[model samples]
Target: MLLEIEKKIASFIEQVDSSFVQELFAKIQHGKMLRSKLMLAICPKHPDIITLCAIIEMIQIASLLHDDVIDEAHIRRGSPSINAVFGNKNAIMLGDIFYAQAFLKLTSFDRNIAQNVAECVVRLSRGEIHDVVMGNSFQESKERYFSMIEDKTASLIASSAKSAAILANLDSEKYYTYGLNLGIAFQIIDDLLDVFGDEKKLGKPAMSDYAEGKTTLPYLLLYQSLSQADKQKLKSYFRISSMEAKEWISEKMQEKEIFEKTQDMARFFANKALESIEGENNLKLEEIIKNMIYREF
Candidate 1:
């Protein structure tokens, strides 16, 4: 199944006339293709399923290119990122190529499908903007954080399932709901992993998000549970990476039950995803949600 999606991506890449773009594509590592997998799971046997997955994958990669540039991310999926190796210009331009290719293909699909996917791109960019602004200072607003993740991450994933449903003549709304929950849950789990995941295994530093000035859910929740002096101390530690700070955070995490609360929140969304698709009896979909919420690193 993934092979077909790869072939489809290759076909699209082959259509581009630039060797640089093609070569750049070769250099970047591919993720689990979670968005593509969600689409395929919804409309597995549809003739256009592979093409749809390919198009979304292009959009996903394009967004990531821009994200890495924004976050100054040097590594992606355990490999050196395009911006890290080739330069930001090449990374940004290659991303444009992918987005242009994806949009070009979208024109060939049903107008609703095309439009639905296009809007997600708008939200994705908006989400990116919100993330940048929020990162400028320590933020504790749960409302803002959830909204940002929905736009940046969940929007595309939701659109993937929604568009597949549209194409497959299935209940688009149900899948959209499921996708939204899954996307939000996915972001929450990512937030948890940033703090709890092994730095070596994740190919990034643990607490990287907090150190970078973006207060993730765990930190926010943990912050709420702290006293005034402790809160001030945590805020002061923002973007400060030292053994002492790490030790302080580790002791707090062990003492507070914050991790369990964060996990429960992720599980809440996971359950919502399952509830949204109650009668579907699609074990693959269930497994997707379960694996997403429960995975370690």
Candidate 2:
């Protein structure tokens, strides 16, 4: 299923946007190279080989390009980001290339499938905007944080699984619901890594969100749960010049309880993902969701 899907996507992309066709093709190929390794690492026998491969490739490219713009990132996957290499203008163009490619591939299916993916795309874009707004304002509300993370990260994953179900023509709502829960869990884990992750492993700066004044899950949870004195101290740090945000983040890291609390929250989301799929008997999907609980950055 994955392989066929990849071929179809490649065919569609090559046909729709011939100007950047080769570059887009190369991008999807690299995406497939990574995904093939991941699929082998996790579930070698995952059904629908052609279709799954194509969707994963499409998703990976779409995400990497968009994320580069979002992070204004200098590097990605251990290489210079498209923006850094080609300048922001071309980088944005490439991101558009990916988006157009996704839409082109999506249109090959029914209206319902296109609608689902279009909606997810809108959500993803809105999520990105929300994060940018919150980061600029240093908003730390938990509800806002959840909404931002859900749209920015999880929506794509949810769309992937739901689209798979759409391709399979499955009538069960279990796929969409499970995919959504899995996306939420996935974002929670990513948020955890934003604090605890290694710069080398993450291919980005550690605690970069703090440096950017973004209030991620850990920051929000700490801000909400900490005592007034600590909150004031933290807020003071945040309000200060650049050097102090780093100092405050370092100080916050010393509080072990806060880290554990964040972990528990991630676990809670992962559990909810499992609950969403309880008794579905789709062993492959179940394994995928369960493995998300322990996925390393």
Candidate 3:
């Protein structure tokens, strides 16, 4: 199913004039396709499932492309990012192109789906703005950080699953909850990986969250237990680019068991996602959610 979706994506982009766009698509790994899989698990028989999955995938890709430009990130998925290779201007334009294509395809479906997708994009943009405003600032509250991530990451996932339920005339609210929890857990694990994951496997630098001055959950938890001097030391390291600073932070986080605490938080959300789907015989999705939170890289 995912292969066919990838083929359709490739065919659609092949019509575009830029060779860079083609190269970018060619390099994409389409990791897991978890969103599509979740949707299919709920409404496998829906005639438009394939198209809906394609739209979801395109939206995800478009968001990542724009995010890389915003972060000025050089690497993604173990390779040079599109913006790193073709420049930020082209990357941003390509992201817009993908968004256009996704909405155009979605027009064939119910108007509600299109509206939800548009609303999701708006929320995502707002979240990105919040992240930018909070950058390198340790003053961010944990509540605000979770809200930002829910809008930035989970909204699309929730909408995608709910859209699938809508198509099937099922309980959209239940699937929405499932997707929401799953997305939050997914993002939390991603934050953990940014701190402790293998750079080679992640295809990006580890401790990138710290380097970028983004106060993720691990740092936030660790900060509360630190002495005033240690807290200041940690804050000072945010400005320093040295590997030693990253290592020092990593060692401190380990000493304080911050990583384990972060994983516990992720597990809590993962369990919530599973509970949302209780009694639904979707064992495949259940297993996927478990593996996603527990994944090493």
Candidate 4:
């Protein structure tokens, strides 16, 4: 997949250098290559592999660059965020560079692929805007929080899988539908990590979402299930009036019901994602999808 993508990108973007554009493109290529390997594990004969890989790289980089700005994130991929090192102005511009690079690579392919990629990009931006606005109040509804993750986190993965099927000229509609479901499952497990997994395993702060006032699924379910006293205690943490609030909330999250409910929801989505791939020779990809449900990070 990467060999095909590098060959095509080289053919298209002839002038390469050690600038930020090159660095951004390189990161995109890395992510695209990983996703492509996951795809190839299922369908080795997939054609248009180069286009799929290129598009994935572009989309992933766009999100990362923008996400750093949105989250005011200091670290990404265990390194200082682009915004932190380069500042918001340049980081945003670099994100734009990546966005344009993705589209430039897309034009080398057919119109359908380009359009599909564009749609996913739009959805991701929309999701991010919604998340920014939700802020501290976002945790009010579990469904609303899940919807946000669907847009912000899972849309790119959905696009990656869908674009691959589309580029291969296979069942594009069903392939994307499967990808969408898989993306939701993948993200639910990611939310679980925010509460239950180690920061070292995830390469970031474990409870950053909570600290950021993002109401993830696990937090939402646990919040809803909390006793009135516990709810009051959790609210105090979100208020940030006292530094001791985190310990109080941590004690409440140890409830078995809270953990089990979130796990059940993750499993439900994992099953739905598997069901979406009926009749496709995608077992290896399916295994990758399922492992995400129980993955440590």
Candidate 5:
């Protein structure tokens, strides 16, 4: 089923008929297709599921390409980013092309589905801008952090699940709630990976988030648990280019058991997602939450 969706994605790009685009696309590292799984899990029997999944995948890729440029990141999924290899111009253009193609495909879906996905794109882009602004300062307000993640990450995931439910003729609101919580948990786990995950497995440098001036949940939560002097010390180390500073942060995080706190927070969101689908008895969705939140172990 995923293969069919991949083939559909290929056809969408192949329509561009540009060898350069094909070359760039070839280098993209596809993840687990989480959005595709969400849709298929909800509406496996829908005739248009393959096409819809392909559209969502394109949108996801486009967002990532733009994000890499914005973050000035050189690696993605352990491979050199397009902006790093082909230059930002080519990368941004390719991303634009994918976004354009995705929306074009989106028009054929039900109006509600189209609107659901389209509105997410607006919030996603806005969220990216918010991240850039927030990155300029040390983010301490949990309220602001949660709001940013909701727009930047969870919006698309939530919208995808709701749209899937719409197709399945199920209760869209319940699935949206499930997806929203699921997306929040997913992003928190992603942040955790940057701090504790092995660099070899992560495909990027561990602890790169702080270097970029983005204080993720781990740092924020840890700060809340620290002594006044330690909190100040952590802030002083922000964006410090020395390996020693990175090590100190790591040592402190371990000493404070900050990662455990982060994991519990992630599980909190995952449990909420599970609650939304309790009566539906969707084991696949249950497994997704468990695998995602607990994958670090």
Candidate 6:
């Protein structure tokens, strides 16, 4: 099933543009394709499931391309980012093309599906704007942080699940809730990885949030517990490179139990996701959600 989805994605890209653009698709083929998998799991019986999965993957890849540009990231998925190799302008154009293709593909499906996807993109753009603003000033409010991630990360996932439910004529609300909670948990775990994960395993620099001036949950939690002196010291570290800040944040997060607290919050959302899908009798889907939150990379 996964292979079929991949084939459809490749075929869709080939149909959309020239061979040069087709080559660009290779850079994005390395993702875990979790959104595609979730859509299939929710609506496996739908005849158009493969195309739907492909559309979801395209949307995710496009978003990642734009995000890497915004973050000024050079590496992604253990390789040079599209913006790194192709330049930011070309990368942004390619991302725009992919997004356009995704919407074009959605035209074959119901209008509601396209509407949902479009709405997700709007939320994603708003989230990115929020991230940019917060990244500059380093907002400390946990509620605001979650709200940003919900729009930036969870909205598209929720749309994927909802679209699948709509196709299958099933309970859209349950799956939407499941996807929302799971997406939130996924981002929280990503935040933890930014602070505590190995750079080699993460395939990018550690403490990237600090480097980007994006305040994550662990930082917010630790900030609340820090003394004035410690906070001042931490502020000093943020001005340095992520490599320099990594060790200091690592030690402090451990000392303050920030990692543990962050993991607890992730688990809380994971559990909420599971509860959202309770009585659905889809143990395989449940296991996928569990692994998503618990996996190292």
By lDDT, the candidates rank as 5, 1, 6, 3, 4, 2
Per-residue lDDT tens digits of candidate 3, residues 112-206? 87887788889888988888887857743789889988999988889988898899888888889998899999999999998888888878778
| Candidate 6 Cα misplacement greater than 4 A, ranges | 242-244
Q: Mind giving the per-residue lDDT tens digits that candidate 4 earns over 24-49?
A: 54443243244566555544675667
lDDT tens digits by residue: candidate 1, 27-144? 8777899998898889989899899999999999999998889888999988899999999999999899899999999999999999999999999999999999999888879999
lDDT of each: 0.90, 0.66, 0.85, 0.69, 0.92, 0.86
- Write down the lDDT that model 1 would get: 0.90
lDDT of 6 by residue, 1-297 (tens): 888888887887788758778777777745787888898888987889989988888888888999999989888888899899889997898888889888889999998888988899999889999998887765669999999999999999999999999999889899989999989998999998888888898887778778778888888889888999988777776535755577777788889999889999999999999999899998767987778777874
* Candidates 5 and 6, the one with greater lDDT: 5
Lowest summed lDDT across 10 adjacent residues in model 5 is found at 288-297
For each of the candidates, the C-alpha root-mean-square deviation to the true structure, in angstroms, is 1.1, 3.9, 1.7, 2.9, 1.0, 1.5
| Colliding residue pairs in candidate 6 | none
Per-residue C-alpha lDDT of model 2 across residues 1-297, encoded as one tens digit per residue: 445556666675676656655664464324324333323323344454354445456655776777677768787666777777667677676667667766765566667767877888788888888877876756767888888878877776666666666656664256566666677777776777877777798877667766666777777777876788988776666534466676666677656366777778877876776676677556766566567666664
Model 4 bad stretches (over 4 Å)? 2-20, 23-34, 38-43, 136-138, 239-243
Instruction: Please provide TM-scores, in order, for all candidate models, with all chains considered together.
Output: 0.97, 0.82, 0.94, 0.87, 0.97, 0.95
Superposed by TM-score, candidate 5 places the C-alpha of residue 63 at a distance from the truth, in angstroms, of 0.4
Candidate 4 matches the true fold with a TM-score of 0.87
Residue 37 C-alpha lDDT in model 5: 94
- Clashes found in each candidate (C-alpha, N, C closer than 3 A): 0, 15, 1, 0, 0, 0
What is candidate 4's local distance difference test score? Answer: 0.69
